[model samples]
Target chain A: MKQWMTLLNKELLEMTRNFKWIWVPIVFILIAVMEPITAYYMPQIIDSLGDLPDGAVIELPVPSAEEVLVASLSQYNTLGLLVIILSSMGIIAGERKSGVAGLILVKPVSYTAFVTAKWAGAMLLLWISYFIGYFVSWYYVGILFDTIPFIDFIQSFFIYGLWLSFVLTITVFFNSFLKSPGAVGFLSFAAVIVLIVISGTFSKWFEWSPAQLLSYASTFIMSGPISSDVWAAIILSVSGIIMLLGGSIAIFRRKELA
Target chain B: MSVVHVKNLKKNYQKHEVIKGIDFELMDKKCIALLGANGAGKTTTLQMLSGLMKPTNGEILFSGSREGDDFRHLIGYLPQHPVFYDWMTGREFLEYAGKLSGLSKKDSKKRTQELLELVGIEEAKNRRIGKYSGGMKQRLGIAQAIIHRPKLVILDEPVSALDPFGRREVLELMGRLKKETAILFSTHILNDAEEVCDEILFLHNGRLVESGTMEQLRDKHQQAKIDLEFKEDAARYADLFTALVKVQSHAIKRNKISFFVEDIELAKIGFLKVIAERNLPLVKFEISRTSLEEVFMKVVEK
Candidate 1:
């Protein structure tokens, strides 16, 4: 336990020194605030473009605050997910390639502790960045449109957080076996995209897949009290995170550090 | 007492074996040099011993226990090229290493401080490793390797990459380290092996070709040779020297010829007779024992 904490502290310090703490949250907040502000001023932005005929009657309906928040999530799903993947792609693969893993593994430290600390550190960064971004989106949505219920905001925040965790878990798992961080990022992104596509296309059949968490989060914002399907999705996603983490540790133990 | 014992250790990547089956024992409080040329499985052997690489087949017993034992706690290892988190200060890196070796917070800090001083890097303790010179990084590497005070510290070519000054500094440090704990260091440099090692293990083509104390190895491979340097026309004497029955083998470079002789006395008499008859312009002539470099080259070539 003590060794694990020591490694965890080291990982966190590495993150801080790399300025992940500063840049990641800043990027998240920028994306979150931009989504709602842009949605509210879409007509003005279009008018300023000046390509439309004079006195053109644009009859686009004002989107609800829930809709704006959901739009913000989609924005995060693309740009935010990209940021998370790019930042974390090197966590394990880079360490192994740089030979730092050999230095640490030679000590009395367990492979499980080393891997778990990395996962926890990545998860910590994900949680902090995602929550702060979500809150920023919430604040802007309330100002530009109707205020979302506090209970509804909290529920969606957790469900969305689960989706991010699932992605980060995949990043860590692939990083354990892959030598190149670029390949790890590519494969992880492909896997998540495939999951989202499959769950979307085969919704009835794959309703319990962790991929449903994204929709579950969106649904919680659009309405309230998600169905039993959401509970099943949450359980599946959490178990998936655990299984991936366990698999990472197993693979890392057997890996040969050159 | 032996701190580590290995029996028939082997490592294979796919069907290609890198480390053929070999065995050796490391005694407590002694320094052993693992001598091998590049690609001779020196690093592979060290990695397996350090628990960084799994041996394809073998038993590595630490203090007579092998089954279900965490022997890593009793061993510290420094790789050929030690990598560190560039963002970490020397002190922080040592603290991390100490903690990983199972030291408590206070104990780790104390040991980190002591090790910084011991490795002569106390002034650079707070500097980030990225900003450190190669020597400072190497000093820090040595400091981290011994922070836990393990029974045996394994250093893989510890000074192979350093400049002369850095090499001397680390060599001197290794001399002091052997007094506290057993050290098993690998190097291709024979002089390094001779300078500080109590026991030498010569590895060639993944096998333990020779191993003994300095005196034992010296006595075992001892051969008499005569070095002759001519002021001019040394090449003229080379053919004549090669034709002599007493000369077993000879190496010639520039104006000098080194003759490894079957009978030193006969070769000396024959050479003196040739010098008088041919009126060779000899600048220097001396008879001496063969060096470890010759022995190593002969062994590896075999």
Candidate 2:
């Protein structure tokens, strides 16, 4: 337990020093802030455009605060997730590649602690940045449109957080066996894309897959607990994260650190 | 004070075996040098011993250790090219390493401070490790390895890449560390091993070719040889010595003459008698023993 905490503290310190603390959050916040400003000014932006020709009229329906927040989430799914994957691509691979992991493991540290601490660190960085950005979106939506109910905001927020957790977990799992950080990033992106593609193509059969997390979160915001599939998805997603993290530990222990 | 007994320790990468069933003992508080050429399984053996790499088929038993024991606390390790969180200061890295070794926060701080002083890097402890020179990083590596007072410290070519000054500094530190803990370090340079280690294990092509103390190795591989330096060119005396009965072979270079003999004691008396009787100019004459280099060569070439 002490060794795990020690490594966890070291990981946090590394993040602080390596500029991850500053840049990761900045990227997420920028993505968060982009949605509301663009949503509110999109009509005016279209009005100012000369492409529509003189006195041309294009009817634009103003999206609700809940809808704005949901649209903001799409940005998170793309740009925000890209930042998370790229930033955390080297979390374990870098350490093992550079030979630092061998030094620590020779001490009284367990392989379980070593692998989990890395997962925990990446999770912490993900959630911290995500929440900070989510709160910004909340603030902007309150000012521009009708306020979302407190219960609705919190539920959707956690669900989106779970989705982010699932993505980071996939990245961590690939990181254990992959040599190149670049490959880890590519494969992580590929793995999520495959999951979502399969989920999208076979929606009826794969309704409870983690690929449905963003929609479940959106549903929670617009309405409350519409289907038992959301509950099943929540359970499966959390278990997926736990299982991947456990698998990473098992891989780290089994493979020679060379 | 503990002994590490490695029995038929083997490692295979894919199908080709890297460490071919090697066996050796790392005695209590004694420095053992794993001497071998590149790709000779020196690093692989050290890695297995450090618990960084698992052996394919072997039993590495630590004295007094029970089955399924978490004995890693008894060992510390440094790689050939150790990479750290370059952003961390020397002091911080040591403290972090100490804490990982299961020390309390306060104890970690205290031990880090002591190690910094002991390793003579106290002046630059606050500076980031990335800014440290090769020598400073090496000193820090040794300090971290022994911070927990482990029974064994495994170093994989700890000084192979350093300049002369850096090598001397690290060599001095290793010499001092032998009093506290057992050290297993790998080096291709025979002189460094001869100078620092109490015992040498010659690893060649993934096998334990030879293992013994320098004295024992020297005695076992010693030949009946004598080196004679002349006041002038020694070529004139070479043929005269080669013609003698005890002299098996002779070689001459510049002002020196080397004689390989069947009986050193008998040959020495015969050669000295001729030198005095013939009024020859003999500046230096001494019986020679096989050096560690020759022993290493014979072991590896075999």
Best by DockQ: 1
What digit string (tens of lDDT, one per residue) describes model 2 on residues B1-302? 45788889999999999999988878887999999999999988988888777889988988889655767888888888887778999999999999988889999999999999988899999999999988788888888899899999999899898999888878988999999889999999988998899999999999999999988898787667799999999887887777775666677899998887878778887888888999898899989876788778867777
Model 2 chain B is weakest, by summed lDDT over 10 consecutive residues, at B242-251
True contacts kept of each: 0.91, 0.91
Q: List, residue by residue over A1-258, the lDDT tens digit for candidate 1.
A: 898999889989999999999999999899888989998999899888888888788988998898899988888888988899999999989988899888988888899998999999999998999889889989989988989998888988999889889999999999989989999999999998999899989999998988777788888898966678998899999999999999999998888876
Off by over 4 Å in 2: A47-52, B228-238, B251-257, B262-287
Q: Which model scores highest in TM-score?
A: 1
Report chain A TM-scores, every model.
0.97, 0.96
Candidate 1 chain A lowest-lDDT run of ten: A218-227
* CA RMSD of all predictions: 2.0, 2.5
Worst 10 residues of 2 chain A by lDDT: A48-57
lDDT of 2 by residue, A160-247 (tens): 8898999999999999888789999999998888997899899899889998888898998889558789889999999999999999
**Whole-model lDDT values for every prediction:** 0.89, 0.87
lDDT for position B20 in model 2: 92
Interface RMSD of 2: 1.2
